[model samples]
Target: MEPSSATVAAYSPCGSTAAVCRAVAEGTGLAWDERDLARGTRPEPVDPGTLVVLGAPVAGGAVPALGLERLGRVHTAFSPCVLVCAYGDRDPGHGLHDLEAIAPGLGLVPVAAVLAPVRHVMVPALGAGRPTADDLAAYRSFGAAVASALRDAGGLFDLAPPPLPPASCPRERLELGFTAECDPAACVGCGACAGACPAGCIPADEPYLTDTARCDGCMACIGVCPVRARSLSDPARLAAVRERCVAGWEGPHRPRLVMGA
Candidate 1:
């Protein structure tokens, strides 16, 4: 089957990376299906003839572990895949290359990759006021170009990228160790927290309990709680990390886009 359709499979906790997927989908100049994994969305394998626009944010200089896990669940090899990684002003390190390294094995034919800039999720001060008009414009154009390329290729496009940098982000496995709790006083048994959880770390039956061991402390539950029942047991850790990041951070990162080789 010839490739003509597009799908966006993204893991965005704070919405920045999701926006990149939107720009890329629109760029494909094709009606695209959105799989916003953060909002508890799951996608089925496609026809292998569609375009897979895979995207995620950087966590500790690599694609968020949960995102990477989720990426493995989706089907892509049969499709031409375009990658987009969103990161703070600081370097995204080997996150994009990490994704590239696995593309072919997943049955995805690599075509293009985009590295987008967004305000720092942890230390907003570092990449302040980003994904500005200029950034969004560039994202849209890049998406369009990739879409056009795939459509023109008629499923024949493939690019085998060089081996990615062996060095990963120094804190590739960095964990914030933050804890989340549901205040029974405030929680009304709403399933919002469980539903919004990307990792399904929240139990639907209880709906108030969090498996911190599995939770990455992305704070999705805290943000989506109806009564604001979810609270962080440890906020100081993130605050401290933010302070340190701002102390030595420098940026206003630039977007990196590459066409299929």
Candidate 2:
């Protein structure tokens, strides 16, 4: 049967995953709707034969819990959905597993998966910036491949489920430290940090403070500040941030599908 309307949704704190999904949908000549879960938006209902594609950035080695909860609510209605988890250079092991664990409960079947890379702000010295020309090309290729897979498969592909045999690797923890030291003396109460933070962890007001619990450690605010006042204590903090951000990630991995659950 010809598919019903398609929805391209994402819960990206940094907009990387959403960009990739939108590009893929456009390239495939698919008319899709976007639902940003980060803004408290829910996925719209899909008609019979409709395809649903969901994407999210792998933060702290997992799809944020909020995204999973929303997916669960609409799982029964959407079957054969594709899950894309965007990451930096690290493996996406635990993040993919997290996606799988949340999907089954919602009754959505996993079809194709991809561990695409996007430029992250963790370590500026480590080539963190907008996706390079090569990066964009690679992501475009991956997107096209996924579009083809969906068209060819007609439904969710049967694959092994995730959380495969926990590894002995020690997970890293995000170091909640500022890059550009915010000087209280020279500080202008612009609240730019609060506006720039992707995770919305920074508060808007004088002596702008960050909620470490809510911070994803993306360092976006540091990059956006005009005063160059926010910065990490040293290179050590940068390394710690990188390690912690990719803690549970296995590195460039994808999930297996568990069928007939």
Which stretches in model 2 have alpha-carbon errors above 4 Å? 1-4, 41-49, 64-76, 125-130, 141-182, 185-187, 196-199, 232-236, 239-261
Instruction: Tell me the deviation in Å of residue 141 in model 2.
Output: 4.4
Ten-residue stretch with the least lDDT total in model 1: 159-168
lDDT of 1 at 204: 86
Candidate 1 local Cα displacement, residue 94, angstroms: 2.1
lDDT scores for all predictions? Answer: 0.75, 0.55
User: Residues 156-258, candidate 2, lDDT per residue (tens digit)?
Assistant: 5433332233422234423344433466655576787776664566768753566766655556567667777676546676677667656654433332221
| TM-score, every prediction | 0.83, 0.66
Q: Candidate 2, after superposition: displacement of residue 167 in Å?
A: 7.9
Model 1, position 1, has a per-residue lDDT of 30
TM-score of 1: 0.83
